[model samples]
Target chain A: MEELTSIHNQHVKDWKKLSTKKFRKQTGYYLLDGWHLVNEAVHAGVAIHQLIGTADQLDEHRELFDDAKAVYAVTPEIMKHITDTVTPQGIAAVVDLPDAHRVPTQPLTGAWLFLDRVQDPGNVGTMVRTADAAGFTGVVVGHRSADLFGPKVVRSMQGSQFHLQLFEGDLTKWIADFKENGAPVYGTQLNPQAKNFRDVHPGKTFALIMGNEGQGMSQELLTATSDNLYIPMRGEAESLNVAISAGILMFQLNQ
Target chain B: MEELTSIHNQHVKDWKKLSTKKFRKQTGYYLLDGWHLVNEAVHAGVAIHQLIGTADQLDEHRELFDDAKAVYAVTPEIMKHITDTVTPQGIAAVVDLPDAHRVPTQPLTGAWLFLDRVQDPGNVGTMVRTADAAGFTGVVVGHRSADLFGPKVVRSMQGSQFHLQLFEGDLTKWIADFKENGAPVYGTQLNPQAKNFRDVHPGKTFALIMGNEGQGMSQELLTATSDNLYIPMRGEAESLNVAISAGILMFQLNQ
Candidate 1:
């Protein structure tokens, strides 16, 4: 076991850098701030590069240390500085970022959720968790979407990331691949010509694409989809929150 | 227009206090932090006690002044101090809080959503917005739920607060009132005996109750409803986000 006390320590400084996307991308690692996520990572067989915690926390969860490639006991002040939390949880982990670009070796089946530039970390994470609950196959985070490995999304996903496949790819290619595999690709829009979502009975093998916060699906993707679908709004609200729309569609279609 | 350049101005100090729930309760007033919300409040016919903004912002939206009882032009520094945004929107309003305790004066004829101790301000507000989009008649923020007028919730609502009625009340009383009016009240729970939400066919005049994020609905409320309903989770995820569940149930039941 290694020990670190000062926030200025080289190892502490490196851990603090994981908060930024650039650092995580460069290092192929990201920080998990609390015990629940660290435990989930251990159960999921995620490659945890380092386990860092206060001496008491490390002793309490000593079993978790065996799963880490390295372990460090740090002062509470150092933990707070590294985790960037006002009230530090006293336990953290440096986990390997799964290969987001890895090609799918298995056949594509079951429902899939695709993000088309959905920018909010909370929305991105909520949709992923909803997809998992809807029993969807996976989520494909398309171009300009929030990074799944970012801290905010990681917090919002609530461990669902371990339950399903998450991919990063050009949505254009993913749409083509779904169609090539005979899966109907559905795009959401508010245009008059778009079919009501209730009318579309999607099967197990299909894809649902949600768009950005202020904008609907891109024109190109909308035109490429098998059919654009809309959720009928009976009230005066101009639109549904994207995450809410995604949840309604996934549960309704999956059923 | 009266102008104040100093962040320490008496009016600025008073406006800043609106951010605290205790101060808001004491004065029966709350703050709206941006132009869009101020515009929505104006259109909704909500009572605007005062409007505060930077000089340029006040000039640009002079028409909004007619609706406000008082208006003040302040420096950007004072505006930031009042609104508390990292980059202030240059505008804000002191709005009268609606009487959350007022009893209904008209017949209840459409679907109503109830929040039972749902604590997350964002979740509470998102559910309100979703209820609005789903054509719900109103939402009852049950005891212990997030304050509807809180800043985080106000922001999440995105003007949907103007689209539907919002109330704060005891869940048991609301459920009883719904029943007395010959409307079925549905409670959400995960118990095995709880009917699948898909199995219930709800009419226009009914109520759907969601529960706390951690604990489900209070046992008393669960037992008092006409029948408790559960969304069937097809995936391994333990549960759906409360807001997502509310969205799914609202749309499904309304249809």
Candidate 2:
């Protein structure tokens, strides 16, 4: 309906701000890149406030703009500046952060995953995606971690965010609530004192806490966990990749 | 130690060629970037043909070159040219590929993991690392997949290749050998007809085949598998990251 050609345009500047975590958090909105992710967000009823793309991308993904969303077309140079990617997928959406900031589900019947300062965006997204596949009840993003609404995190989740409950809370408080709710909360540590993951026969309602890539779970949360589980490494690698370990633990414990 | 300041020096030219897959394959050598990986290769008794680093990195890790065939100091400018990374870690090595081409251990008494055209270098490396953590016997790198010794993959593997038996072979032949040796082989696909991974109570000796990022396992290998396994998804995500699924399968199948 409208065209923006200059990189200095006010709207373009505002969209570019979404690239930063502070701006996204402040505005309660973030951008989704590529057609597949935006399509999933649309199908999941995410509150998409605006769609911007080149005419060709619009023609191909035309169905995505069907509802109450402002639409804009941008010249190729403006598109390049807005997205900041060399090969822009040529489409993006300005959407509200999903309603993931909840207290752990009140009943706490399904499994929950808590990430403690998991800094890498891809790792954060992969952990969330796997938690969904393992049928975990929800994911609680710990404070000081990669922003869940960041573009890289969104891409790595591959739209799994739309399918599951996501929460951000002080993990200390979440662990306390889960313990009070009768869901045995577990944290991972690499030590002889920790029980092997294979030994865990957790109930349907439980919580698993995965922590920072280099630093394991926070000391305060580890102390609160009912049991600290270790995934044994027979190899010389000091540790497993954080997301891979999360997947193994979630599926094994959920079963 | 000798010093190499010119990026166009004859030896520097040859070393830089290791950055490409075809050149590395042709020369039977590849580059390892960063101190952690180069250190691991040194300790693992991997054939490191040459070591290159700044004076400080070399002095700190001098023990690494005690028995090295050759060692050299390079200018920061030249170091930048060779690795092409913004932060080069001030270290790298030209190392021979490990002897990962052996036939599947003929008796095939332990678990085997196969990668069938999994293209993402990080995914391929993570798969190998987790397989080692799960105590699998060996990993077979199938054709058309990421080069296991490529810089990105070598970094992601975190030196797990040294801890496990790695073989590059046609997966079809490996699957046949696995079956012929009385080990049940499993292939992953996302279909209702396939058995859910949780339903599998597999024995200690087995072979698990993971497929390409987009395409599942090739039909040739799929038909050879004793069972096609599916990691059931409880949420809306279409499938798990290849490395994450491999981690789940390896640990669950091992148990």
Which candidate number maximizes DockQ?
1
How big is the positional error of residue B56 in model 1, measured in Å on the Cα after superposition?
1.8
Q: In model 1, what are the clashing residue pairs, if there are any?
A: none
Q: Tens digits of per-residue lDDT for model 1 on B158-244?
A: 888889888898888888888998999999997657899999997789999999999989999988999999887877688889999
Q: Compare the candidates by lDDT and give the number of the best one.
A: 1
Instruction: Compute the lDDT of residue B117 as modeled in candidate 1.
Output: 96
What DockQ results do all the predictions give, each relative to the true complex?
0.87, 0.72
lDDT of 1 by residue, A62-108 (tens): 78877889999999999988877788789999988888899976579
Instruction: Let me know the DockQ for model 1.
Output: 0.87
Question: Which number leads on TM-score?
Answer: 1
Off by over 4 Å in 1: none
User: Any runs in candidate 2 off by more than 4 Å, and if so which?
Assistant: A99-107, B99-105
